[model samples]
Target: MSTSSPMRTVLVANRGEIAVRIIRSCRELGLRTVAVYSDADAGAPHVRMADEAVRIGPAPARSSYLDVDALLGAAKASGADTVHPGYGLLSEDAGFAEAVGAAGLTFVGPSPEVIARMGDKVAARAVADGCGVPLPPGTGTLTAGQAAEAAAGIGFPLVVKASFGGGGRGMRVVGSPAELDEAMAAAGREAGAAFGRSEVHLERYLQRPRHVEVQVLGDGHGTVVHLGDRDCSVQRRHQKLIEEAPAPGLTPELRSALSEAAVTLARTVGYVGAGTVEFLVLPGTSEFFFLEMNTRLQVEHGVTELVTGLDLVALQLRIAAGEPLPFTQDEVRISGHAIQARIAAEDPWADFRPAPGTVSTLELPLGPGIRNDFGLAAGGAVAPEYDSMFGKVLAHGADRDSARRRLVAALGELRVEGVPTTAPYLRTVLSSASFTEARHDTGSLERDWTPDPADRPGAPSGTAETVETPTVSSGTIRRVRIATDRGPVEVAVLGRAPRSGASASPSRRPGRESAAPGASGPGGAGAPPIAPMDATVVAVRVEPGQEIAAGEVVAVLEAMKMEMEIRSEVAGRVAEVLAVPGGPIAAGSPLISLT
Candidate 1:
């Protein structure tokens, strides 16, 4: 049975574009809105846009957005009657949702029991099986010993996944038995950090699967409808960078099956509110398996909204308010096409490293059938404590080709400065033949994509100029005064000592050079796997005297909300471990010396 209650105010328990998006919807509904922020976002735009705001905790997510007590306190203090967890952060956290309800505030999502049931990979798979939804060949949750035994039956080239993780965390593909232990270890660490769980399971790994998901909406009145399918095959390191609705080139039968399957699963779970049902499809085939269900609004939901001409957030609010189905399945109409590009604060050409800083300039694309969801304004600082995604640009048109053209043109008109972004890279992908022809798969990025070396930060061209610096002995800043037409100006200059021997540059800065060709033996003295970018060492997997094979992960570095594994380029013995977990590292700094 569903309960009906009116909500006067809503607290958006999230930070970033999603929060801004929710506030707009609440404003349209004539509802007051509250915003929560951490110390790092005290002055953020979301905080200023809401009817009321409160500081939850510190910069780290653990102390702020993920802190259930802090969020509950804010809601109570602000007298918010409802809570909207706008994707990521705590949106999918079942416990947090339960806490919000216990505090007498409605969570704009499914019940906590439903969330827990679908959020756990193991349980979700069982639910899918009972619902007759196809699933990938896999095992239930497993221990370390159980995983080994399961791997033997699953054979090589299997994926180990955290039973209670999402967004690609706690997942690893093991090609052989030798790599199983290391993969499990890395997956465990990432799983623990991402979801606070270390338990994992095994599954058969598909080499070239296309990721397709359906946007599902359900009201407590037993009405569930799918908003159609989205093709999210374009990704980097398992994180989606681009998404589109009505998955290109999908057969009508297949599309119907996908949608029907999603609705079936939602009805089986008695799902309520906004949710996403994801699937993995084998390229060039209609066979697809249930991947997982996200029990909240997705980041790419705007694309579906555009194609379907509906406000998902508004629907979520109505459902949570005990409203019945606004329309029947046959009444739902999906026309045209829509695409969304995730503009992240990172340099695509530089291993997609985080490039957080102040936004010196901002220019948004404006035209018919175009929308840019963002929280950034000129002079706003993009903090490093949160996800690197700063905005999303979406476009719609009467047809797929038209939509693609509009999206590409809009991306070209978009401009940003003071930090590198994936804008240019996204444009390239949109124009690539593989994408236009809909031939790309999940592994397309690793196999066929390469960043343009010339793509720089999103800054205006012809305005950048180089300045020469004088050699200095120390790394401290010195004050200097310059005369200007208006008045005298003061500037601070930091100095750096030249690298020894290699005065031109630090190409061979000690302990960084590769081994001489023809060298042989365990102590061959090869160049170590250096830090690809400045990041925090989240995990070190190797130790001195440990033997590792080529392609083995030696350490994991985290930057800009993404993780990169530093792997051995050649088989050798670990000679030294220079970095430890929680340590800061500079680009090109040796992490593990190999011999």
Candidate 2:
């Protein structure tokens, strides 16, 4: 267990950017690495970086990333002695941790009991209270009358939260008697959807609870230490957008207290490896309340690593090997500052709707302090089946001010084409006054922000052009060409654009061409068929050996929480079903080849 002894081979049990991160750390530590991938991630950056790789399952997380038996089988087959489950997916699943340990492979995290205790928000609160940590005023599970009475005791403006969810999924603020039931029901529904539980608890909601979290590392030898704090208040829809270490605007006394609280919580849990203990710091008071503990590495752990100059993954591997605490409390140091922006594949203008597609071109930022944890290359598809995050851009400097300025500048020059992304929107946030000075909270995004009209893509600055309309859909598409001063061009309304007064017109358009039964149609046998928008295939209804009728749905796709039926274009026997449910196939991936 000594630091001098080394590990030979380790398997990264997850995919995407974090897997690549662990692989790099293993390389630095003189350890061979294995990468696991789903069908959708076969060509990902992490797979290419690893020394070896094995396919876990199909694209869906249940079959792939969260498949514990397959992952253990792989470690046994590959002769891997250790397995590292990065954040999300199976990282916090206590059963998965126990399985890895039972298989005699080191699970690079806390013990299974610790994972279980922390994974359950209700029990975690009990432990924190037992350890003398301050919890916001709240009540246990109660019926309608009891909930109302408890809310009265906790005062108005309290939050109802599900006992099993984190990252603010099952939490809702209720301020009045009329809204308590509705709010509680909504919170419970969200909890049930997110964590498979409808049980919820209530707590007093702090209006300006600054999102502050302490990073800590522990080992089985009963040693724990704090590595400073990060500010994660910049958020939208309860998701963090920007994170920075050495949280801006912290006094010496508060910082010390936060660090001590984090270390105390770890000691209470007998924790190990890298974990984050988050707190909701009330803005104008010294009273901070426990939010929840993340039992695995965090998405923003990179900022902490940048400032502390420690490879956290290496420490995790070392601890799992039963090494004694590497350093004393005083040995940890906080230096400089680091800022990270989550580059999401969402449309900022459309309520941050997930926009997933292929990347035609990508010009990511590059410089001394700019770091990109990207998972995609040019032409890689960002399918709608998974999370809408492409990656994060991390920048560090001598201080907070320098780091902020550099991150803003770097994002300005970065470009991602093809799919709609928040790259332009993030640049605007970086340059805004509130973000520049770090003078904001989680609600500031909804408060002081506005969409920049100029960031939207449209026409060029100076151009003399005939705007050609798009002709789309393999069905009847109407297009007409109109002559202008510039030249002759087409303006076809690819598919049917919605019109007013019930149902307006049919395959007839204004500018270019129209299939008016006799008029000429666009090239392509018929009109080149287009998938109805973008969506993930949830079920394929047709099989190769079965026949489909004209109106029958060949596949079902889900997008924006709506199920879309993909109907057959031609009535014939299905020759092939090119895509499977839960697989991330492109828009044109043939669902059924009809004869």
Candidate 3:
């Protein structure tokens, strides 16, 4: 590969906001862009933003985004010379990279061999060790017998993590030997569902470690540089909620060391394109350990872009085109501070359950230093078939405090009716002392954050309603009624019917209604374990005649990328199982009957 040839057209092998973001960059660079979408994204914003759009497959990722052959076919059909895989959904698949190159199209990422080496957690640890990078006490992929044998040395309170896949999927913490089996089993199931691999390994679990990561960029010409660091400490179940650039409160020496380590690891593997090298910083200590390397653009790359004043997507395209580094390490400078809050279609009050439906009205905040990356349009449907995140709000300012203040203000101004979001919760996080003081860790949300009832529908927090004023707005939502006398209306009521070109109402979907004559618990006494929210039953772990304990997991329901276990309400024989795996169920629907 050489920089002599020009990249004529780039096909974004992804969907949603990232795809639109890439297209915007390509457009600015005077390069043509193509978009690929599944059946669910036929009318998506990315499709309309591209020079050309192609429908690859059905709604599921396996059939579309993750289908390497299909993506290559799309590139060929659209005459695209390059493919940009926005984060997640097979972005780090080495096989996909190889196939794209074999099809005579650039993958816009690291080489296939490098991707494989870094994508595998077991192999990545070896790479880090060879490069003299600090690593945690961990083992490679282990069989059940090997895991049991190694558990003795690793000790208790270790984590079983899937060797493939990220986003906290397929990870479980075992506090003692008694919990190892169940943890391993659960991790395997989640890993298999997320990455099609169940292989897991053990690592010493650090208590409340800061999830800091360095952004690294490398050219094929052996130039690897760091773009500062980000603190993604605010999280729930391993999923990042808020991320900020420059990792506030890091000593100069420690920050330099972390950046140097990231660059060292990137250069070691001859990495190309944009990537993230994550580290776990011990609480109240300067010590840090290698966690994992994301071999593609990260979800929070926007915050980095805002702070560094660079177009990462543009840089990735140039790198894949075999261009040399445009600037030296010293030239890469960071200015101001930036923070990003992920807005997902989930109800924080209801255990963060998925809140999928049509967006009848969508109003994003607008102001200086505020950036909103989104995918949903007016009347757009938020389908349950994909990730729950629909958008992100990024704020930038001259300092950390200013950035935090701007982010909080932007969140308050954002309004997306018809489906509940994590907006209110994110606001609370930004205002919390832990976050404001930069003292939060990865476990901050789980330990200190709790959903407020006022954030939910029908629960107005600090508002005094007198007269409601109605006005029709353009786009998806036509009318918005605002309370005149208000001290901040916290809750958002459900929106009305679809405006136009929107999918059928989520309420009309089959099996979305509660089953009549709800089954009773043991001894014909209490109510059965009803579904907490609308979700698809992914698995059933119990049989009709099996005797179950009160807290035993009977079934697992998946919604908004989080798995909710349905436990037996009583200790008795399973009288009946009403839900089937892969079947859709509504809130209040019974999952099992015990007697």
Most accurate candidate by TM-score: 3
TM per prediction: 0.85, 0.78, 0.87
Point out where model 2 deviates above 4 Å.
1-6, 141-155, 175-198, 457-494, 497-595
Error of 1 at 423 (Å): 0.7
Off by over 4 Å in 3: 1-5, 455-457, 460-525, 531-536, 547-551, 570-572, 581-589
Regions more than 4 Å wrong, model 1: 1-5, 454-534, 541-555, 566-578, 583-595
- Assess the local accuracy of residue 431 in candidate 2 as a C-alpha lDDT between 0 and 100: 82
Global lDDT of model 3: 0.79
Cα-based lDDT for every prediction: 0.79, 0.72, 0.79
When summed lDDT is taken over every stretch of 10 residues in candidate 1, the lowest stretch is 500-509
The per-prediction tally of clashing pairs is: 0, 14, 0
Q: How accurate is candidate 2 locally (lDDT)?
A: 0.72
Give the per-residue lDDT of model 3 (tens digit) for 326-386: 9899998999999999998876755565667777678999999999999878788787778
lDDT of candidate 2 over 279-384, digit per residue (tens): 8887756777888899999999999999998888888888887787667878888889999998877656544645566776778888988888877887776755
